[model samples]
Target: METNRNSNIIKLKQNLKYRNILIDAFPLLGLIIIILFFTIITSGNLLTLNNLKIILNQMFLYLIGGLGSVYLYAQGGIDVSMASNIGFSAILGVRIMYQHVGIGIIATLLIGSSIGLLMGIIYAYAGIPVFIQGLAMDFLLKGTLYPLSGFKASIPVPDRLLKFDNKYFAWIFLLIIFIFIFFTYNFSRFGKECRSIGAGEIASIQSGIKVKKNKVLAFFISGLTCGIVAVYTLIRTGSASQSTGLGFNFNVMLSLVLGGCVLGGGNGVKVRNAVIGAVTFVVLQNGLVLCGASARAQDIVKGILFVLMIVFTSKMYERKV
Candidate 1:
C-alpha cells in the first residue's frame, strides 16, 4: 500500500511538471500559430519586405506602451488613461516644438510623467482605484484636447521634428528602452516588490514592502513611456488630432495578455511578454488587412481573441494559486 501511494504521488508530480512546461511555451506557440495562419490567409503577402517593415514600424508604440504598463500590471494595477495622455502630451509638445524643439521634447515627457504621478498620488492617498482614476483622468485629458488644439481637427508637428521619424531612430530607441525595462523588471528590488504586491498585497505589506511608494513609481514609469510614445507617434504621423491614440490603451492590454501575462499579475509575469505580444499584435493587425478582412471583421476577431486570452490566462492563474 505504501509503495502504491508513493508511485501515485510521483506520477502526479510528473504531470504537473509537464503542465508547467506547456504553460511556459504557450506564448511562443501562439505567436507561431498566428503568423502561420495569417501567412496562409494572405497568400504570403504578410511576409513581404514592405509589409514586414510597416508592421515593425507600427509595433514600436505598442512595445513601448506595453513595457511601461508592465510595471503597473505587475502590481495588479492599470492606467487606461495612457492613450489620452499621449494625445494630450503630443498636442502640448508639438506646440512647444514650434518655439524650441529641445524644450518641446522636455515638456512632453514632463506632462506624461506628471499625469502619471498625479494618478499615483490620488490612488495612494485618496484611495481611489486605479481603473476609476484612469477613466476619470482619460475623460479630463480628452476634454481639454479641443481647447489645446484651438478647436482644430488636427495640428501639424513642426517640420524640423520630422527628421526623427525613421526606422533607424525607432530601432535604436526601442533597444534602449527595452534594455532599461529588462534590467529593472527582471533584476531589481523594485521589480520584486511590485510582483510581490501583485501576488498578495497584504503579504507584501507585512513583508515590509512600501506598497504605496512602489505603486506610485510604477504609474510614473507608465506615464513617462506614454510621453516617449507620444513624441514618436507625432513624428511618425506629422500631426496630432482628437482621434490620435484612440483604442491604444486597449491594444496595449491585448498585447500584454497575448504575450502571456496573467491579468492577476505575479511571478509569472515576464518582461519578454511585452516584446512578444507587441510583435504578435502588429503582425495580426497587418495580416488581417492583407487578407482583406473588413475593419468590422477585424474588430470582431480581435475582440474574440482578447476575450479568449483573458479567460485562458485567468484559468491558468487559478491553477497556479
Candidate 2:
C-alpha cells in the first residue's frame, strides 16, 4: 500500500511538471507554431529580413501605447483617450516642427504632456471618474482638431526632425528606454506601491501609499511616452493630415490586451508582455501582407484576434466557503 501511494505521487508530480511547461508556452507559442507551419507552406518566403523590418516598424506605436498603459491598467485604471491625446498633440507638435527643430520639438512635447496631464488631474483630483474624463477628452480632442486641420491640410514634417523613424536609431533608442523601464518596474519602490494599489486601492491608501498622487504620476508618465511617440508619428508620415489620428482609439486598447494586461487591476501587467504582444501583432500583419492580404482584410483580422485574445485570457475569481 505504501509503495503504491508513492508511485501515484510520483506520477502526479510528472503530470504537474508537464502542465507547467504547457502553461508557460501558451503565450507566443501559438504564434511561433503558426509561423513555422506557414513558413513551410510558403516556401520560407515569410522569414525574410525585409518582412521582419516591416513588422518591427509597425510594432513601434503598439509597444509605446502598451508600456504607457501598463501602470494605469495595473492600478485598476485606464485612459482610452490616449490616442486622442496623441492626435491633439500631433497637431500642436507637427505644426511647431515646421520651422525650428530644437525649440519646436521641445515646445510640442511640453504641450503634449500638458494635454494629457489635464485629463489626469481631472480624474485624480476633481473626483471625476476616468471613463467620463476619457470620453470627454476623446470628443473634445476630436472636435477641436477636426475643424482646425481643415481636412487634408498637408503640413510638412522636416527631414532633420524625421531622424527618429530612421529604423536603426529608433530601434536602439526604444530598446534603451524599454530596458530602463523594465529595470525600474522590476526593482523600484514605485513598482511595489503599484502592485499594492493594484491589489487593493483602499488597502494601499491605508498603508500610506498616496494612491491619488501616484495615480496622477502614472498618467504623467504615460503623457511623457505620448510626447515621444508624437515625434515618431510625424517622422514616419513626413506630412500631417487632418485624419492623422481619427480612429486610433481601438488600437490603444488592443495594444494593452495584446500585451496580456487585464482590464481590471491585479493581473499580468508586465512591460515585456506588452512588447511581445505588439511584436506578435506586427509580425502577423506583416506575414498576412506578404500573403497578399488587403489592408481592409487586415483590419477584420485584427478585430477577430482582439476578441479571441480577450476571451482566452479572461479571468474569474471565486471565494471558497
Candidate 3:
C-alpha cells in the first residue's frame, strides 16, 4: 500500500507539471493566433512597415502602464483610476508648459506621483477595498479633468515642446523604462514581497513583511509610471483633451490579461506578460480598425474577450488546486 501511494503521488506531480507547462504556453499561442487571424482578415496589411509603426505608437502607453501595474497586480490590487490620473497629469503638464517647458514636465511627474501616493495612503491606512477606492478616485479625477480641460476642448502643447515627439526618442525612452522595471521587479526585495502578499496576504504579514508599506510603495510606482505615460502622450499627440485618456484604464487591463498576467496575482506572474500583452493588444486594435469595425463593435469584442479571460483564469487556478 505504501509503495502504491508513493507511485500515485509521483504521477500526480508529473501530471501537474505538464498541466502548468501547457497553461503557460497559452498566451504565446493566443498571440500567434491573433496575429495570423488579423493578418488574414486585413489581407496582410496588418504587418506592413507603416502599420507596424502605428501599432508601436499605440502600444507605448499601455506598455508603460502595464509595467507599473505588475507591482499592484502582484499584490492582488489594482487602480482603475489610472486613466483619469493620467489625463489630469497631462492637463497640468500642458497648462504648465505655457509657462516653462521644463517645469511643465516636472509638474506632470509630481502631480502623477502625488496622486498615486495619495491613493496608496488611502488604500493602506484607510482600510478601504482597493476596487472601491479606485472607483471613487476615478470619479473624482474625471470630475476634475473635465472642468480643467474645458469640457471637450483640446489644450495644445507649445511648438517647442513638440520637438521631443520623435519616434526614435520614444523608442529609446521605452527601452530605458523597460530596463528599469525588469531589474527592479526581478531583483529587488520589494517585488518579492509584493508577490508574497498576493500569494497570501495574511501569510505575508505573518512572515514579517510590511504589507501596508508595500502597498503604498506599489501604488506610488504605479502613479509615477502614469506620469511618465502622460508625458509620452502629451509629446506624441501635442495636446491634452477631455478624451486624453479615454478607454485607457480598460485598455491597460486588457493588455496585461491578454499577455497572460493573472490579476489574481501569484508567484507565477512574469514581467514578460506586460510586453507581450501590450503588443498583442495594439495589434488587435489596429487590425480591427483596419477591418472597418465600428468603435462599439470593437468594445463589444473586448468585453467578450475580457469575460472569457476571467473564466479561463479561474479555471486555471482551480485546476492548480
Q: Which structure among the candidates has the greatest lDDT? A: 1
TM-score of each: 0.94, 0.85, 0.91
Misplaced by over 4 Å in model 1 are 1-14
- Using TM-score as the measure, the top candidate is 1
Off by over 4 Å in 2: 1-24, 147-152, 293-301, 316-321
Model 3 root mean square deviation, Cα atoms: 2.4
Candidate 3 worst ten-residue window by lDDT:
312-321
Query: What lDDT, from 0 to 1, does candidate 3 have?
Result: 0.87
Q: Write the per-residue lDDT of candidate 1 for residues 1-321, one digit (tens) a residue.
A: 999999999999999888887777777788899999998988888889998888888898899999988888999898999999999999989899999988999999999999999888898788898889999999999999999998999999989899877788679878998999999998999998999999999999999999999988999998898899888888889998887888889889989999889877777688878988999899888888888889999999988987887787678766752
Residue-level lDDT tens digits of model 2 in 98-128:
6677767787678667876877788779978
lDDT of each: 0.88, 0.71, 0.87
**Candidate 2 collision pairs:** none
